[model samples]
Target: MSGSILNLFSLQGKTAIITGGTGGIGLAITTALAEAGANIISIEVPHDPASPLLRQAIEATGRKITVYDCNLKDHESIRATFHAIWASGSVPDILVNCAGITRHMKVEDTPVQDLDDVMAINFRGTYLCIQEFGRELLRLQRPGKIINFASIAAFLAQTNISAYCSSKAAVQNLTRAVSNEWAGKGITCNAICPGFIHTKMCEDLYTDKEFSARVVARTSMGRWGEPEDIRGLAVFLASAASDFITGESVFVDGGIMGR
Candidate 1:
């Protein structure tokens, strides 16, 4: 293959904004994008200790990273962060909506507040970021990429996470809606559904031997996913490598969904 063909995956000179880029799968995705030559802007909540670590790691790669402390659930906060990002002279060519929350409660036991919280952080927050930044990309006539973080729960119903599953499903649909609306404007939107990744968020489940065994047994890979497992897909989605793909939900679940 020619060098130009191979270089389609290169993200040189691109800038990326990653929501929830401080830890877990978010951190891994941020680093991978940075290593692939994209300037990183990590959006995190205030006082998150992991933010500094993530920044340092990305900076060590000789790529620039800017950390903004903004509450994803708060509209004003998100607006302010965007203004700051623009003022700082970083215009994003890619956006990864990785910030999200889940509440573990059965449908009968789920409080209205819990459901509202999940919707705010997972669905509404993602929507707001895309709307605001996407407009800028469109106005500038820049071809941009957006990757939303969905979950395998969006496809498979799980116990004690009714609100989470519903919110993720909304995200998947929202990706399609956004892509359909903006495809003519040179923007691509898609969702990533991850299953049982070994992140801090799922440490408790992994710690339980019986539960872990059951999860492993259900997966065709017979193992849980590592944070790094998601890096390549994230990079591919953000680069020109996936330019022809949009409005699709790609699963990175170790084949668990097939079972």
Candidate 2:
């Protein structure tokens, strides 16, 4: 293939911002984008320690990576983070809203505060980042990519995670709404629905043999997904390869949704 054709997946000179990019699936996606020649800016809360492993991984790709500690739940903090990013002279060409929290509580047992917290970080935080970064992209008249993190739970009902499920479902719809409003302005918005990835978030389940077995059986691939399994999809959505695709939810599940 010609270099021009292969350039569709190349992210040379692109700048990317990944929320919650310190560990797990977020870190994997960040490294993949960096390997594709995009400079990475990782955003996480102040209290969260930086991931040395992730820093090493990105550096191994020979791409620049910057880490910012911003409280996504606080609007002022988000704005301040954006201002700093602007001052640094690296405007983001891709934004990935991957910061989120999940509480395992039954609908009836879920505390109101817990519900509010989930919505605040997952949905609200995602929205604020998009709104702020999106405006900058629009003002610059640049084509940008946004990939929001949703979950398979958004499509299928799950037990003891009503708030989480609801929040992710809202994220999927929010991606569509943003895509509809901004496609004309050269922005493509999409959501990624992952199914039971073996990250720290699911360490408890993985440790439980019976539960792990059941989950493995449920997946057509007969195994839980790894964080790296999501990298390719994230790269695709962030690159020109997916320019014509918008307002779509691409599932990275191991054929679990089909079963």
Candidate 3:
């Protein structure tokens, strides 16, 4: 209320580092921040296929996009990537932990390896990014925001994808832990728990007409969420508008979990 809404959301001159910038959700967030005048730094796995198009999309918004290849599971690589960004004279003011993977398997059927893999990226990887990002911001003596890509599953019980759900649960608490430690300083950590959005992760589930219908019927919106549905919230969290907000997991679930 103190500032113009436009100014509140403007990320002009801010630099954001996003993990999984080539994916559906990540791409939407990248474009949104870019349109709001923030320079983009996308952290992705080596040899990612979606790099070219993701780059073009951000550039099309008339903002700069730099891609960094880092394995989140490898602390050294993650550290080196941030070092390179700092060496290049660009410090990240925002960190978006959007890189996540899920496997659709029942609890009984979930393999030990699958759980490790999901936890590594969805949980451990997020922790690692927050660690490095916090280190950079504290060193620079600046304020920063961290937006983690959690899921509706974090709060509600769901069938299959046990590993994914548990990992997201970890993410929710992790967001709290990071914020608890950093909010008093110069950093605010939060999460966006998306519902059933139409992305590569849901392609197979969408193919199951009955299951899809059930999910839709449960939601008051009676529709699936698009990548576009998440862009505005992503911008708000990354901007000064949400300075007072931290350590909470907000939902964009289209009323699915409300029931």
Candidate 4:
């Protein structure tokens, strides 16, 4: 790539706030952004053991990383966490709402509480974080980027995960709604729809030999995606290179969507 193209992807002096940045795909995103030269503010659950490991990983890239404890399911907690982040003088230029949960129960068998739990974290939590992050950006009149983690489930109805599918569908639209409102204000919002990646969230499913076979056969690439596979798009969406793109859901599905 030319110097001009590389420069567009540089995140030097920028700071990013990522929810669920301590493990799995979230850790991949944290590494990608940090390697791109952005300082990191990782919002993880209280006392998550992975926080220290995440700190060590980012520091290895020669970038600063701060970990904050927050319960994403609570709106007040999200607000207070953002406030604390600001008070610490790391006003972020990017926000990645990568925190989510899923329940693998059929619709008829799923409890109302389970449904509520999925929606609370996947959809409501993302919305609350965006609201808080956007408020700060608007107040400062600064340009910003917002990346939400939607899923291939948002586009397809998978069996036994009705609540997870529904929540991600809401996230897909929410990304567009935010972009419509924020794009002209110098803030671009987009969603990333991942396919069957080999993350802990789907470890059981992937470990099932027959199920894993089906996934590999279905994906044109003939393999499960790794956390590292998410890096390039994550970097692009967080950087100036994607400034013209907003309200779009880009899939890094290794051709599963194509199939």
Candidate 5:
């Protein structure tokens, strides 16, 4: 029984393609997967400034690493990237869609282009990656896992980030829609809804003492969540432990939703 349980979390033979792996939470997830024995394929947009540091860190783990410059909004580019992965003879067993963007403007002041930009990366990009990965898994007749990044904003509204909130809400449902369509074919799709995690994305907001105190006071944990707070769940969702879980949006929001 102990051996069987241990096997549940083992990712020894899996390969993972993680979008936005150079980012804070994404890098933490990548490290967690590597520690559990999965090879890493870190994908980012072209000329990402953080890639070099991320590559070095992943290298320190002694796990296999491949870097791809992928633009998820461009269907042609996405197809090519997946094709290149297949050509390398390392089909992905897991995909972590952590790539997203946000614009901090109220609906009244937000420009149309900004909304479109957020949707292009956060919504359209996630959908395309899921679609392409599902195709590849279907072609190979392999069971696969897909983890999408939603946010606490998917359920609750906050100020000045309407575009981001809307995109995440779409992603929350997209996870369900994809699971309904693909679960019978041996793919499990799910989303992780995180709250005010301390990432580069939230640096400015978290630095504001007044706003920070308000969030912390409201949070059941009374502290901001760190990137590392997300890694353990990521490993579980990507492993055999969560084979029965699909089409669900799990919250890692420090009880924000409960409140």
Candidate 6:
């Protein structure tokens, strides 16, 4: 079944919708899916263009990367972006919800707006995108995949970022709820729970030698995860290889959870 197995992981002729696909872990996932043979449609904020290096990387994969500007925090913007994507004649086969934000503040000190902002983008945005993606798939009677970007915080609470932790927890369960409703409709929903990956989101913590050392010591692998560490699973979950999987949260941590 070697050949069949390879075929299962192939994404030829597929199109993927990836939010925040210009940088960091999102960019990693975009390149991975493209290299696996899928065309990409990225949704980013206005005025945020993919860097030349990133554009070249995707171009080198012999796949196209088209970006649309949308404010994930805005309901109308999300809907309009999807409509624009469909109007452009691309039928997305996969959806990767990789955009989110966090702030390091004590719950008592965090303003209500801060918590709302975190939830607006991390949880509500994910749900809205999934809502739009699911509608199109169901309307066309097609099979598709959804890969949500959850965090280790979803499983284990962390210090000073209560809002982010709670939002991710919501996303983890949202994956299950979505799968239960849409799995029978030829759509698969799941999440990727990253543990201490070396991305911009964790830069603040990583620069602190003491905290970084503590993270490394706690993780069984004795190292932090790189963005590229997510490539294989991103492709697998986006391809037919994971057809039997849904409502699951797979970790790409460097054995952090194992300890």
Which candidate number has the best lDDT? 4
| Tens digits of lDDT, candidate 4, 1-259 | 5998999999999999999887699999899899999999999999998888889889999999888889888888989999999898877699999988889988899999999999999999999999999999999999999999999999988999999999999999999999999999999999999999998889999999999999999999999999899989999999999999999999888898887
How well does candidate 2 match the true structure, expressed as C-alpha RMSD? 1.2
Q: For model 6, what is the error of residue 118's alpha carbon versus the real structure, in angstroms, after optimal superposition?
A: 0.9
> For model 1, how many clashes?
0
Candidate 6 C-alpha lDDT tens digits along 1-259:
7988899999999999998787689888899999999998888888775655556778999999888889999999999999999999999699999999998999889999999899999999999999999999999999999999998899889989999999999999999999999999889999999999888778988999999999999888898999999999999999998998999999888888776
| Residue 94 shift from truth in candidate 6, angstroms | 0.2
Candidates 2 and 4 compared by TM-score, better number: 4
Q: Give a tens-digit lDDT track for model 3, residues 97-203.
A: 99999998789998899999999999999988888889888887899999999999988878888889999999999999999998988699999999999998789
Clashes (backbone N, CA, C under 3 Å), per candidate, total 0, 0, 0, 0, 0, 0
TM-score of each: 0.97, 0.96, 0.97, 0.98, 0.97, 0.97
Which candidate would rank higher by lDDT, 3 or 6? 6
- Model 2 scores a TM of 0.96
lDDT of all predictions: 0.91, 0.91, 0.91, 0.93, 0.91, 0.92
Judged by lDDT against the true structure, how good is candidate 3?
0.91
Candidate 2, after superposition: displacement of residue 206 in Å?
1.5
What overall lDDT, based on C-alpha atoms, would model 4 receive against the true structure? 0.93
Better of 2 and 5 by TM-score: 5
Error of 6 at 236 (Å): 0.3
Q: Poorest 10 consecutive residues of model 1 by lDDT?
A: 134-143
Q: What digit string (tens of lDDT, one per residue) describes model 2 on residues 45-162?
A: 7767556777888999999988888888899999999889988898769999998889997798999999999999999999999999998998889999999999999999899999
How many backbone collisions does model 2 have?
0
The superposed Cα distance between candidate 5 and the true structure at residue 69, in angstroms, equals: 0.7
Q: Compare candidates 4 and 6 on lDDT and give the better one.
A: 4
